[model samples]
Target: MQNYFVGSDVGTTGTKSVVIDEGGNILGFSYIEYPLIMPRPGWAEHNPEDYWNAVADTIKHSIEQARIDPRDIRGVSISALAPACILVDKNLTPLQNSHIWMDRRGIKQAQWLRDNIGEARIHASSGNPIDPYYATVKLMWERDNRPELYREAYKIQTAADYPCMKLTGRAITDYSNASLFGAGYDIVNKKWDTALLEEIGLDPDKFPDSFPCDEIIGEVTRAAAQRTGLAPGTPVMAGTVDSVAAWIAGGATENGDMSLAMGTAGVMGVVHKEARFTKNMITIAHAVNSRDTYTTVSAISACGSVLRYFRDTFGQMEMLAAQSSGEEIYDLLIRLAQQAPAGCDGLITVPYFMGERTPVWDPIARAVVFGLSLSHSKSHLLRSFMEGACFALKHNYDLIQQSGIQMNWPLVLTEGGARSPFWRQMVCDMLGVPCVFMKDAKGAPFGNALVAGVGAGVFKDYSVAKQWTEIGASHQPQQENTALYRQLFRIYRNIYEDIKKNYQDLADVTGFH
Candidate 1:
C-alpha cells in the first residue's frame, strides 16, 4: 500500500508529466512536444487548449507507464511557464491564444508603464521591474489592441492556473506565479495592490484568488478524471511556476540555496529568508515556504535553445549522420565543440538570441558573435556559442553577488543543459563555483510530485526534498580556464555595452519590433 503522486509541467515548448514514489524515485515519465506560435516578429503565443490537451495526454501516458493503481495516487500538482497571459471567458474558454513568457510584443506597453507609473513606484509595489517580460504589460497590450477580447474576458489566467482550472473547475493562482503578474502584486504583503492596479488601468477583479503553493485548492472532477486517467475527486494542490519546481527538484529548499535551471531558458534562482528585492532580478515567493521565504530569479531569454537554434539552422550534416549512426545530434555537436580550445581562440559570443531578461532588460538586443576569423572552423564557432551562454550566466551571477545576496557555494545545476558534463564544467569554470547535479534528475515534474506529496500528507514537509536529492558528479573550476574566461567575460560585457545602443535601431529598421 505505497502512496504515489503525480506532477505535470506545462512548459514553453512542451508538456511533461511524471509519477513518483515517496522516496523521490521517478516511477513514470512522459513528455510531448508542441510548437510555439510566433505569428509575427517579437510575438510568442500558444493556444490555451494545447496546454490542456498536452497536460491530459502526458498525465494519461505517465500513469499508464507507471503501471500503478490510480486509486493509490494521493494527490496531483501542476507547474507551468509563468506570467503568461491567458484570458478566458465565463465558460472557461480561452478568448485567444495565450501570450507566453517569450513574447515581447508589449514593449510599448511596458514603456508606457515606466513613463506613467514610474519604475520606482511600480517596483516598490510589485517587487518586479517594468519590463515586457511581465504579464501586466502583455495584458495592457491586449486591452489596448484587442479591447473587445479584453472586455469580454472573465478572468486572466497563468499557464499553470489554466490547467488547474481545467482539472478542478477552479480559477486560482499560487503566490509564486502571482508575484510575476507585476500589475500590482505586493510581494511583501502577498496580496494584490488594488490601487496600483487601478493606476495602471487594469481591473483587479480580472485576477484570480491566490494561495500557497502546497495548498489543496480543489479536487479533480469526473470529466477531468476521464481525460487524465486519475481518480475522480483526487486532491489538486496549487502548484507553482516551472522554474520554482526545478529549483525544488535541485534541492533548493533552504535559504541561500541557489540553482541554475538551464532549460529552453536559463533561470538562476536563489532562495532568501527575507524579502530582498533587486531591480535587476525577478523576485517571487518560494514554492516550499510560500509565506515567509522568497526566491530571486535571473533569467536569460534563451539558453539551451541557442544550441537548438544552431542545430536546426546549421547541423544538417550532423543530423544526417546521426540518423545513420544512431547517435544524438546534440552529442555530435558537443563532440565537435570539444575540438575547440578554451576562449575559442579569442572568439566570444553574447547570447541574447531572444533579447535578454536580467542584468540588462533589453528587449531589442540580438545575439552577437564577435571576433569571427577566417581561420575559425565550425567547431570554434560552436564552442564560442557555448561559452557565450556561460558568459551570459556569469554576467547575471556577478550582479546577483553585487546585489548583496549571498549565494551558497557548490551551486546546483539542473534541467536540460545541465545533463551535459561539458556544459556543467563550462559553467563551473565561468563562474568560479563548484557545481553538482543529481544524476538523471527528473526536473520540474519531480518537484511538482514532491509538492503533491507534501499537500497529500505523504511527506512531512518540503525538507524531504533535500533528503531525497541524489548528488551525482561534482565539477570544480579549472584555474587556467577560469583565468581565461574572466578576461573574456570582461570583453563580452564590453562588447554588449559597445553595441547595445544600436539594437533598437536595427530592430526598427528591420521592423521586427
Candidate 2:
C-alpha cells in the first residue's frame, strides 16, 4: 500500500496543513486563517476550538485536493507557535482563550518572577529568559488574576499539545516545547524541575508528559478521525515547536548551520551541539534529539507582520489594483517599492509594531519611522518597511555572531517572506551574506511532515531532511548595497536606542499597563 504523511503547523495567525508522500513531495496543502483576539493592549489570544477546527478542515481539504485515500496517511505530525499557554479540562476543552506568544499582559508577573526567582537561576534551569513571552509568567498571571480558571485547569498545554490531545487523546509535549515552559523544565537534566515547580507553587502534575520530537505519542481516535477526515488509529508523532521545525525543513540539520524564517514573526536559529545560556537569547533543545544538541533562537516579534500591517492599514490602492489585475498584493507592493531607491531616501524604520524579542526583549517597544518628510512618498515608506524588516534580522544576526557562534555562509531562508526576490535581496545586502531560499516555501508544515515521515519509519532518520530540502535560489550581497545599508543600519540601531525609553513612558501614560 502507498504511504503518505500529514504535517500541520498551528501558527500565530493561521494553521497550515500539508500532505506529503513518502519521498517528501508536497502533494497538496491548505491554509486557514483565524482572528487574533486583542482584548487589551499587549494582549493576544485565540480560542482553542479555532485551532482544532482549522486543523481538521485543512487536513480534509488537503486530502481532498490531493485525491488520496485516507488510509494511505500512515502518520501525522504538528508544529506550533511556542510559549503559548492553554488551560484545558480533562475533556480536552479549553477553559478559556489561550494566551498566545505575543501576549504581554503578564509583564508584572514576569517581573515578579525575575525579582523573586532570580532571572539568572531561571535562565540556567529553563534555557530561556524570564519574560512575558514564556509560558511561566503567563501561567503565574492566570493563577494570580483568575483564580477560578486556574483552579479548574486540568492541564496546562502548549499550543502544539492542545491539538495533539484533540487528535490522539494524549496530553504530551515535546522537549523543544517544554523548554518554553520556563523554569519548570530543566533543559540540562531533561526533566520537569520538580523543585522549581514546588518553589513557585505550580503543580508539576499539571504539566503534560514530555517526549522527543519524532516520538509517536499515540494514534488518532475514531472520533478525531471522523472529524479530520483521516483513518482511525493513524499514528501521530509528538512534533515540535514551529521554529525547530523550520530549522529542520530549512536544511540546518548540521551544527553551525543557520536558518532564518521570515514569517509573521521573524526567527533566526543556529544549530548547536552544546547548550549555552545567554542573557537574551533562548537555547532550546533541538527537536531531532533532545539529549545532545541545542538550537539558539533569536525571535523578532514583528517582521513580515509589519508589512502586513502596512498592507491592511494603508495599501488600499495596491490591494484594489491587485484585485483587478489578479496579482498578489505583496507582489504589487514590491513593484511599488521598486520605484523608491535604496535606503528609502534617508528614511529609516524600526519594525516593532508588536514590540520585540531577542536582544531587547522589551514588550513595550513601539514602531517608529524616522526622517519622514513631505518629500517621501508611500512607495518610499514601503521600501523602508522592507529594509526595516531586514535590518531587524541583521540586528539579531549580529548578536548571534557576538556570542562567538559563527554560522555557515549561504544561510538557508524559508517561509512565505523568502518567496519574494526583492525581500531576499534586501536580507542578503543588509546582513552582508548570501541568502538561499528553499524550494518548499511552505515553512513549518513541510518540516512537520518530514518529522512525521521520520517518526513513522518511512525514513530512517533526520538525515532524510537534507535530501528532502533542496536549494531553490541564492541571493548574494552586492557590495554597493551592503555599504549603503551599513550606514542606514547604524542610524536604525541608534534610533531605537534613543527612543526605547520613550516607548515605556508612552505606554504607561496611555494606560496600557
Candidate 3:
C-alpha cells in the first residue's frame, strides 16, 4: 500500500485539498470554488452543502489526478474558515446557511454579551472580545432572532464541525475553534466552562462535543463515503479553524514567530505554549491541542480584498488593458505603482470597506482616501490601497506587541499577500521588519498534511514540520521608507479618530433595528 495522506482546507471562496506522501513530498491537489451569499449588508452566509459537495469533488479530483490507489490513502485532516455558525438538528441536518466569520449581524448579541459578562472577564477567560466575529455571539444571535431555527438546533457547530458530523454521525469541534469564541470557553483549562455558559442560559451540552487537536475523532461513514471519494472507515483527525490551521501551515508552532496571512481577509497570529491575553489582543486556543496552549491573534477585516476592489473598481481601465494584452493584471498593477514613490506622494487609504474589526469594532466604518489631489492617478490609487493595508496591519502589530508577548523577529513565515513583492515590500517598509519568504507557501493544506503525518503515525510530534517547510527569498526594510511610513501611520491613527464621530453618526442614522 502507498499510504499517502490528504489535507483539506475549507476556504471562503473555495475548498482546497492537497495530497502528500509520508516523506513529505507533494503528490497532488484539488480545489472547488463556492459562493458566499450576502443577503443583507451585515450578513454573510454559505450553504453547508456547497462546501460538502466541493469537498467531495475536490477530493475525487485530487485522487484521480494523483493516480494514487484509494487503498494508499491513510488518514485525512481538515481545516475551515470558521466561527461559522451552523445550527444542526438531531439528525445533523443544517438549519440554515453557515453564518461566516465575517458576518456582523450578531453585533447586538455581542454587545449584550460584553455588557452582561463584562468585557474584561470574558477577555481574561476566553482571550477574545465579545464580538460578532466569534461563534458564541453568532449562535446566541441566531437563538434570539430565529427561535424556530434555534429550537430545532440540537447542536451548534461551525463549517468544519458540520462536515465532521456528516462524515461520522457525530457533531464535535476542537478546542481551538471553541476558544476563538472566547465568551464561553475556559482557555486555561481547555474546556467548555459551564459557569460562563450558565450566565447566558446556554447549556454546555447545547454546543457540539469538543476535542483536543490531533485527536482521532471518528471514522468516515457510508453516507459520507458517497458524498466524498474517501473510503468508509477512513480515520478523520480532529481539525481546526482556518486561522489556526494556517498557523500550523506556516510552522508557527513555537512562540514569538508570527504568521501573517492576507487572503480575502488579513490575520496576524503567534502561537504560545499557554493561553495568554491583553486588552488589545485576543488569545485563541491552538488546534494542536494540549494543556498550556493558545494563539494570540489580531486581524484587519480587509486587506488583499481591498486591492481587489481597487483593481476591479478604480483601476478597471488599467486592469482591462493588461488583461487584453495578455499581461498579468497584478504584475501590471505593481509596475504602474513603481512610477509613484514609496508614500504615493502623500496619498493614504483606510481599508474599512468591510468595516473595521481588530483594534476597532466599528461596523459602521467606511473606506477613505487621504491626501488625494488632482495630480494623483490610477497608480497612486492602487499603491495607496495596498500600502494602506500594511498600515492597518501595523496597527494590529503594535497592539499585539503591547500585549506583552515578546516575539523575536527571528523568522516570519508569511503567505498570501507576502507572495507578491509589491505587498511584501510595503509590509517591510511600513513595519521595518524583514519578512522571509516561506518555503512551503501553502497555507492550511500543507498544515493539514503535516497533521495527517502525525495521524498516520509517520511522526510522533510536529517537530518534523521543518522538513515540510521551506524558505525562498528575503526582503529587508528601507530606512527612508520606514521614516516616511512612521509619519503616515500617525496620520492613519488620526484618520480613524477624526472620522469616529462620522462612523457613530452613520450608526445613529441607521436607527435601532
Q: lDDT of candidate 3 vs native?
A: 0.79
Models sorted by lDDT, best on top: 1, 2, 3
lDDT (Cα) of model 1: 0.89
Report the alpha-carbon TM-score of model 2 versus the true structure.
0.92
What lDDT tens digits, residue by residue, belong to model 2 across residues 400-473?
Answer: 88777657888888776888888889899999999898877557888888888888988887887787677998
Q: Model 3 TM-score?
A: 0.94
Error of 1 at 503 (Å): 1.5
What is every candidate's alpha-carbon RMSD to the true fold? Answer: 1.9, 2.4, 2.1
In model 3, the runs with Cα more than 4 Å from the true position are 410-413, 507-513
Residue-wise lDDT of candidate 3 within 2-81, one digit each (tens)?
77888888888999988888777767888889889999877889999887787777777887777887667877778888
**Per-model TM-score on C-alpha atoms:** 0.95, 0.92, 0.94
How much does candidate 1 score in TM-score?
A: 0.95
